[model samples]
Target: MGIEAGVAGAVLGRVGASERVVACTAAARAAGVRRGQRRRDAQRLCPELVVAERDLDAEGRAFETVAAAVAELTPRVEVVRPGVCAIPARGAARFHGGEEALRITVQDAVVEAGYDCGVGIADGLFAAELAARNGGGGLIVPEEGSAEFLARFPLSVLAGAVPDWDSLADLLVRLGVGTLGEFAALPADDVAGRFGAPGVLAHRLARGREPRDVAPRAAPPDLTVVRAFDPPAARSDEVVFAAKALADTLHEGLAAEGLTCVRLGVEVEFADGGVSERLWRHEGLLSSQAVAERVRWQLSGWRPAFTGDGTEAEEAVWGGVTALLLVPDQVVPDTGVQRALWGRDGDGARGELPERVARAADRVQAMLGHGSLTRPHLTGGRGPGERVLRVPVGDMPLETRPEGPWPGALPAPAPSVVPPEPRPVAVRAADGSPVTVSARCVPSAPPAVVVMPDGSGHRVISWTGPWPAHERWWDPESSRRLARFQVLTPQGAHLLTLEQGSWLLEASYE
Candidate 1:
């Protein structure tokens, strides 16, 4: 977007879904702004940074330009992301004279189209990506030299190439495994035993091996599923709604044969006779809901490219979608799950129940809005309200509770009911006087009775606490100083807070 709009100087694009910086120009990177940093943190790093909300549609359109330029050389282009892509180079290399010649030709094409890119060739996709990023202009790794070429890089590189490797990478660093070569040297069996599947995959990549074999058995002919709209669906949601059912059917077909696809291809045919297609990667088999989300993202990114004028503004008047197709790529035999030996239905209601819940959530979210359904995640805080956060169902949990201990936090057996907002109530002493907390964190008197806002009273059977907390004292705008108490009454147990001479019912223990 910065390039298209000609807005130069420290530009960063943040994904709204995660509220994290997903892409940044070289200027921002040089200024110490990195991807995954919060928007505020990035802004702080580069005060003059120009932040832009990412538009999947624009990304889809811009990549079309890049893909078109590359497709001129080879038709088998596979996009890893909006800014990165791959192609089987052996055939293209031979056709274009050699690897070096092919690399030069691909780079020249993209540069001529007003974009800069690096071309790289290696034994596997992972090494090739590193080569493209690290190689100046372009570099071609000689056959059988991928492992040697990857040895010099740090273990941190694996975190970017593989999913869920960040924590593992950090652990490796702490254990003196600083480089890829060191990690690769570990016994494969030991790595598997310690880290399970993710570690094994990372170790394979570190050794210059692709996560899976290149020539996976082709999916059976009947695996591809298609749905055609009668009048050509005009709205994107209409297609998305259909995708959910299609994905369910596709998964069922795959399950019947005990198979799963590591990569999925979503194809959309416009009424104007233009076809938009993209490949999505999911190492852990894609769920039905996950497939529908990919379709939605593909549509969002494809809208501008589908427009006649190739502009976002003109997309509203573009042709409708006529048909949709789903093709499972990289078909492999599924390593089926082992059922629990003790109880048939183990913990968390495993099996069809979760899928049913996910489908129900999808429909509800479609009818309402994305934020209509949410799940609570625990995070670092001294109070029950501060410790819990509610986020939309499908969003990634960007924030996590720190492993460190909180000095003033409450003990175990957390509250069962945390209201959206605190409800004000009165806490009275035995003589009907209001209860208060002193400067030394001592209660004025034992809380004898709790009064509801409606004037009803519940006699306190037992009481504990004056757990005081001083939080964020440096930030006056958000600073908080409060005292909390737990009181058991005839009706139920309640978590109460006293601040500024008033008591508020914070939560209740069932």
Candidate 2:
């Protein structure tokens, strides 16, 4: 369904090497090299192969680029993977003049982005993916031809479809069935009884009898509003402002419709050709303020470059932020009885509070950064310290914190003063004796400190022995031993140690 530019080969190409040597390398169709295949072996298989180291970041950006381009044709773009995207054609076809024109436009845009891709449009995601793989380049499966087109493919394509592939394939081969057309002709009940649920599903799929509906195009709420930037704006602050305006408009529209929004979808187009979408859901109807807050929160998490203050800078920034769309995913109708009881009072009061909270949270996140705003989540682990972890504001539930604090464990809410790269300090004894740290030293024994040339000093007011920590002992090359010590000093308290007998400051409490 997509072209994987042999990421490894692409990565290898960045380095100086013979293109011929790289091309000769035989890799899996997706650029996945076979097990035990050496670089030389790959070079031998594809003589003109250009080996370039995979740039995952760039590829990620590229995927976004392609997704945005596709979005021009249809708003509903589901990214199948980093290199593949799927769009339901029924609605897009009507919007883009026709199915044929839509297909050509999508293909041309993708190709212009320097990627070779196979585009498949079918009744469903699975069928489309399969069609793309088989059609190669640009393939369209007509609605009526879905069944026939799928029939000719081998059962091998559906081997992993359901049940276990190996067992089903072995059984089918024993019975002389190979292609999907042959498989579909068999009685469904007979195959199901023999192979179980997967066989039944596979049979149905091969016959183009989809059990589920194609991705449905939900009718957007009547209150939905969208804003497109002529030159996409890339600044987070600017985007947030735009989102605020849009949210206000949406809220007003919803009020006029006598409804309240419970869920919203935010889609943004980036200047460097990237598209990002986030879905936000609230337990109850949200006010205009709440919606704006969510938009600001979402934009703050994105890292967009800023341009200096000037007309040119404004133009440049706007060019990057191509579009912003806010759709109400869910809404609740205002019951006549409830609307009569509180009238406008309930409406005005309820909405403003959530909006205020959202704005506060957004501001806090903007100041602290994304991961810094976290909530305690419990996780599966043995110790209390290991049981609980912090997660982003809107992520999966946290595992439970371990129960009951352990004796002599590190203090709660561990000191927040630790530096990223702890500076090493020389510890000295009260008598200014240099307690020579070595592999054989005991951690319980006090060691005096000495100041390094770097001018940082901590005297070992009290000392502990150098405890040996052997890690990765099974790995001959990676094995390492570290000595830990708890040292106290008038300057500060610290956990100092020697690693492989070399003095290092592992941690410090300042």
Runs of candidate 1 with Cα error greater than 4 angstroms are 1-21, 28-50, 214-221, 228-244, 267-278, 286-323, 336-355, 358-374, 377-384, 390-510
**Model 1 reaches what TM-score against the true structure?**
0.65
Cα RMSD (Å) per model? 8.0, 16.4
Best by TM-score: 1
- Tell me the spans in candidate 2 whose CA falls farther than 4 Å from its real position: 1-60, 159-167, 211-510
TM-score of each: 0.65, 0.39
Most accurate candidate by lDDT:
1
Task: Give the total clashing residue pairs for model 1.
Answer: 0
The CA lDDT at 404 in model 2 is 26
Residue-wise C-alpha lDDT for candidate 2, range 1-510, written one tens digit per residue: 122543334233211112112121223333433322334555555444455445434444456667666766677765544456777688888988887788788888887877666677787655776766554465788887777887887665663244345566778889998888888888878877987766777778877777333455556456657888765665656666788788888878877878766557777777667666755555355555556655554444344334355333322333367788888865666453222121123222221323455567678888998676666554433223344466765455543432322233334334335444545666555576545555555442356664643786645577554555565579989986656566666776665556654566555665
